[model samples]
Target: MPKSNTIPVVLTIAGSDSGGGAGIQADIKAISATGSYAASVITAITSQNTLGVLDILPIPLAHIESQLDAVFQDLNIVAVKIGMLADADIINLVADKLEQYQPKHIVLDTVMVATSGDLLLKETAIGSLKDRLLPLASIITPNLPEAAALTGLAEPKDAEQIEHMVTAMRQLSTSAVLLKGGHLEASDESDDLLITQNETHRLSTERIRTPNTHGTGCTLSSTIASFLAQGEDMLSAVSHAKQYITQAIGHADLLKVGQGRGPVDHFFMLHQ
Candidate 1:
């Protein structure tokens, strides 16, 4: 148990990544790294490693609802980070829970596919997410591919096209959209665009050359939610979270974990 004022509690509703690289595990680690208490309502369990997902066992909707109830009933949840919803029912369940609890901030990581190119959410879930979850999100973070999928656009090849895609995504979600540029090809810099109700801002960083980026998206979204839980405004929270993930990627240890791509060292800055 944490002191009432001391621990800022953040809840993550996502899948479990057995690789410990991404998903709920990464969310918890990122939350803790930012000095926030982490709680979880797991949507699915994956038999996966850095290489790929071998199997997926989705938790029943009832159980997921129970988990949400158990946490929100007791804890003062300050913020939420959502990831890896496996189906429409689960997405609706989460949306209903969010509506009931109304956490201060909601970071929606539109986790459509895995890093290894596996589709994580079902086809019907896509519609449910857009119709139900998008409006409730405080910030929706989608990588290039996911953004393209959500907006039904062919992948944008240039920054201008990417901006167009971001504009399209803004219409779908009432919240701020952070369209990540990790998968986009670039000559000089990797850039992420933040489009909100008020303005569109670009955040550029020197692209880190590393394969050890297994959980970067999950880590970044959770980091932002944690900062929001700690009372940072949306833009400042996102800015700091971007800086944190960049440093994590840069300092990623080349540990040959699982004989494939490895995870960013979330604990890297602490041990340094």
Candidate 2:
């Protein structure tokens, strides 16, 4: 194993969630919780809480590029987790930067909508995200809503439907797709499918019943990137990430930060 002091670094390129439940905040927390250093590039800012997003202000493209350059110049960023790029220009800029820096692993959470049903990504940018960013990702984690938007399919309601969506999404040329089934809340179990070019792994767990699932996607993807940065392969990284998210979600009700959907306990281990 690498020296303990040489912790792998994971960079998150995304938006700022002022509520601290999702976006860059969640990414940093999950990365740190999973034993990696975290760096961030905030492409946008959202005034949001567990209730919903009320406003969005996208950062300038030049500044986003500068943040990417600044982080890549010094830190040894082994993996990258990309969340909300709010527009077409931001998507192109991030894709260009990824082309330039060429991080070893890229986990793209196609963040289109929030947990409270607020749209975070511009519909106009979806085409650009597919054309530029999807091809570059090591894996793309799309929940039911995002998968439907990306693949032009209906939102999944079951494990079989989610797998079907993954099959459709693979045509977009992504090397891997982690189709998240968390939004199928009516089911007794959560099924996340990891579909790669050659294999498909079904990862199922008992669904934790709670409204405090805000930031779950960001947390999972960033944690997966962290594990990858720490030298775990794709399947192992995803499996470990699943375990981490389950634990986080199971402990989420312990936090009373919001009146509506609360956040997962990213530092649940510390709280023990």
Candidate 3:
């Protein structure tokens, strides 16, 4: 007899993107595509589209805390992917809840700005995020701009600079760092550096040129968490996630979700 498929539950604690291209929406889509159940705790709600973010409404700390409690109390959550928390209060609240429940895998996407250049995290809350939530993460995934913000280093232009910046970021927390290189200019191939205490690994691939690159960050982090929930080791999980995102980006033109930078096709594998 064949073994049964176990559907591991993965939680995403992030903001709601009304456009359905990024944030909690993208996380759920990517997790579902990877054969995991996605449960969400919304930290904020945004009125936005692929073109840009118009407005944001931060969820109350009390309400956010209740939602976290509700999920942790009932679910056997295997991994947690955390995205935009919006404010200091929300960040603090999530940190407290995660400490209490202590989920096995926590992948933190330090979302500071959107693909459309709209600010997602408040300037004041950056400190709180670094001081409190970062240490709790199992791995912290930051795009170039977000990595610069965290490390107080200028945007790295090459692999050597990126490695140096990653070293600085590692000192901030015990969590492993995945410094994304997609935003680097003039790159022959986009590369991501994953630095853990024991070793550093590089995952590189040709850049898929597509306007539909709206939710790549959200999708990548969520997929990584999903793989971890399915019992893959961290290195294997990140490696698989790189392959998944590359495929999604390659097939991004299939989606016509919005007027501007649409969305990566999270279900691209199903069509093939």
Highest TM-score scorer: 2
Clashing pairs in 1: none
lDDT of each: 0.90, 0.93, 0.91
Task: Give the Cα-based TM-score of candidate 1 against the true structure.
Answer: 0.96
Candidate 1, residue 191: CA error in Å?
A: 0.6
Q: What is the lDDT of candidate 2?
A: 0.93
Q: Rank the candidates by lDDT, best first.
A: 2, 3, 1
Q: What ranges in model 1 sit over 4 Å off?
A: 1-5
TM-score of each: 0.96, 0.97, 0.96
Q: Write the per-residue lDDT of candidate 2 for residues 87-111, one digit (tens) a residue.
A: 9999998998899989999999999
Report model 2's TM-score to 2 decimal places: 0.97
Each model's total of backbone clashes: 0, 0, 0
Task: Find the 10 residues in a row with the least total lDDT in model 2.
Answer: 158-167
Task: Give candidate 2 misplaced runs (Cα > 4 Å).
Answer: 1-4
Residue lDDT tens for model 3, 1-272: 99987689999999999999899999999999998999999999999898999999998888888899999999999999999999888888899889999999999999999999999998999999999988999999999899889878898878788877867876878579888999875777989988887788999999887778999999999999999999999999999999999999998887777789998999998867
